[model samples]
Target: MKKLLLVLAALLVAACAHAPAQSAKEAGAKTERNFSPAHVKEVIVKGKTTQKEILAKIGTPNSVKRRSLGVTTGPAEVWNYWTAPPLNDVAKGGLQPVTSLAVVFDDNGVVQDYAAADSSVLIQ
Candidate 1:
């Protein structure tokens, strides 16, 4: 009886641990965001574009984070935008494909740098 109880307890703990990952996977599988790389390139410029300009041109970012640039530059803000394949594709997938853009801004709210990645190309 004690051995059986121990096994049941372990199984319960494993189920609890797995619940969050399953939830996250389901969430990702349902996410849909889309944007054009050409538009981003035309509007966002390093050392010139301000946060407000980006907002006006591209709309709101999906996420924002505050992070350290380096010891010399101190902290900076990062804005992230992304485009992902449809939920149907993601749900059927081995690896989910996405296109993403990250914009870094200085303390003065001017863009410092930006990068974009398109994983859809890899699948094609």
Candidate 2:
């Protein structure tokens, strides 16, 4: 049994070793890094954009949440994305405030509201 387990582990490691590496564009590893306070304004707009548009602008969200609230007049879908400087930029002695953006969509996937929280939680 121990030998079987070892063989399985070896196979797993070999499979992982052969997997293709992720490229920067495919990874979207903070390609739009080091956003200023005004950057969110330029990207996200409430009641005028759709979830599809947001995805196109921001690539992929870190998370997506959906809930059916009993309330009749609020968002039912939420998409979250985080912004921070790349390591190189951070090493240059610049301030990189980590910010989280939550975009809420109605039943129809149209953006209803959005909020950005900084290390200081700048609600706009």
Candidate 3:
């Protein structure tokens, strides 16, 4: 009876370990949906871009904020993108993936300084 109990306990531990790992992988895949680095680069690197052009190309940003032009901060426009958690696994702890792209426009409303948030979260 002792040996049988020990064997059963070992099997239960092994099964539990494998179960949690699959959940982690599923969480990671859920986060991957909203992240698109390629799309971000394409919009920023191109020459002579206007706000209207950016809107047309990438569609509407997730959010936007405006700032005044200054020495350290010449005109600021922030754009955000996000992906929600998967529907079936709502109980699991998963972050809503978010990326922000900031575009500073010159007086003429052309892109002056374009910056993107560090995408390390998505890469992992």
Q: Lowest-scoring 10 consecutive residues by lDDT in candidate 1?
A: 13-22
Clashes of each: 0, 0, 1
| TM-score quality measure for candidate 2 | 0.54
Model 1: pairs clashing at backbone N, Cα or C within 3 Å:
none
lDDT of each: 0.66, 0.63, 0.51
Better of 1 and 2 by TM-score: 1
Clashes of 2: 0
Candidates in order, TM-scores: namely: 0.58, 0.54, 0.46
Off by over 4 Å in 1: 1-35, 68-72, 94-97, 121-124
Flag the better candidate by TM-score, 1 or 3: 1
**Candidate 3 at residue 59, lDDT?**
48
lDDT-best of 1 and 3: 1
lDDT of 2 by residue, 9-95 (tens): 545644443424568776665365422346667886777888777766665566678875576665688877665444344344334
Residue-level lDDT of model 3, residues 1-124, one tens digit each, is: 5434444554564444341233665555443322255676776653488878766565445555666545455555555444333323233323334355656665566777665653322111
